[model samples]
Target: MAQPYRPDDRSECVLAFEALEGALRCLKDDIARTERRCQEVRRAYRQLIEVAASDAELPRVEPDSRLYRLTH
Candidate 1:
């Protein structure tokens, strides 16, 4: 079972706020790094798909069509 909530003293409350701010800053940095990595992965996947689409065995798609945009 969880303990009942208790209010902190003034100094403790200030420390808690500092810790929370530090954690949020770290989280923002982590999110930015992950987003960049995801973009790289997406670009690599698109390149592979383009190569597969160019193969003679596959049917060709119209460049101007929505289907082409969806696949690539």
Candidate 2:
């Protein structure tokens, strides 16, 4: 059995919408933070690559090695 539509239903609907809007705002903030962190990681990776390239003493990773596979 379903309850008949009433004036209180409108208020309940409004409250649900407000809650969803708050959740959406939080999600947007999380995405922005993740994007910034990804940019930072990319910058660090580039710097590391540059440093490694300048240092010939570092042992070269074999193409078949696990480290090479994980990185590439």
Candidate 3:
């Protein structure tokens, strides 16, 4: 037969809860940082595309080209 489950002391339970809350807070911060970095990357990519489009010396893109497909 299995023994009945025993709960931890109140102090131990409180400590565990606090540790979990701290971990959750750290994870939320990491997610926020990643989202910010992604936005920065997207902004940079758009700026690069604008610069490329305005450059006169660059070869014209064909309709079938992958770059044309992506931009279109």
Candidate 4:
């Protein structure tokens, strides 16, 4: 469903156009940042897998017993 172009009101139309263009510019910036973050996550996963396969300083994850939890 589309409407016909009625440009009798020029200033208002210009303002609306500027606002929409600004919004689109901000959207593009946000999208680029998100893409970068996604790539970084992929690289981190690859590094984690490499470390796991080889001998690396793995973080110590100690499982606590019921008594240990009660004390702490």
- Tens-place lDDT per residue, model 2, 1-72, is 323345568987776777778889999999999999977876776667668878999776677976454345
lDDT of 3 by residue, 1-72 (tens): 322333567776676677778889999999999999977876775676778779988676677876554454
For model 4, how does the per-residue alpha-carbon lDDT over 31-52 read when each residue is reduced to its tens digit?
Answer: 9999999778767765665566
Off by over 4 Å in 4: 1-7, 55-72
lDDT of 2: 0.72
Better of 1 and 2 by lDDT: 1
Task: Give the local distance difference test score of model 3.
Answer: 0.72
Which run of 10 residues does model 2 get worst, by summed lDDT? 1-10
Model 4 weakest lDDT span, ten residues long: 63-72
TM-score of candidate 1 on Cα atoms, chains taken together: 0.64
Candidate 1 C-alpha lDDT tens digits along 1-72: 322333557766676777778889999999999999978877876776688778989776678976567445
How many residue pairs clash per model? 0, 0, 0, 0
RMSD of 1: 4.9
- Residue 59, model 2, lDDT: 74
lDDT of each: 0.74, 0.72, 0.72, 0.65
lDDT winner between candidates 2 and 4: 2
RMSD of 3: 6.7
Backbone clash pairs for candidate 4 read: none
Question: How do the candidates rank by lDDT, highest first?
Answer: 1, 2, 3, 4
Candidate 1, poorest ten consecutive residues by summed lDDT: 1-10
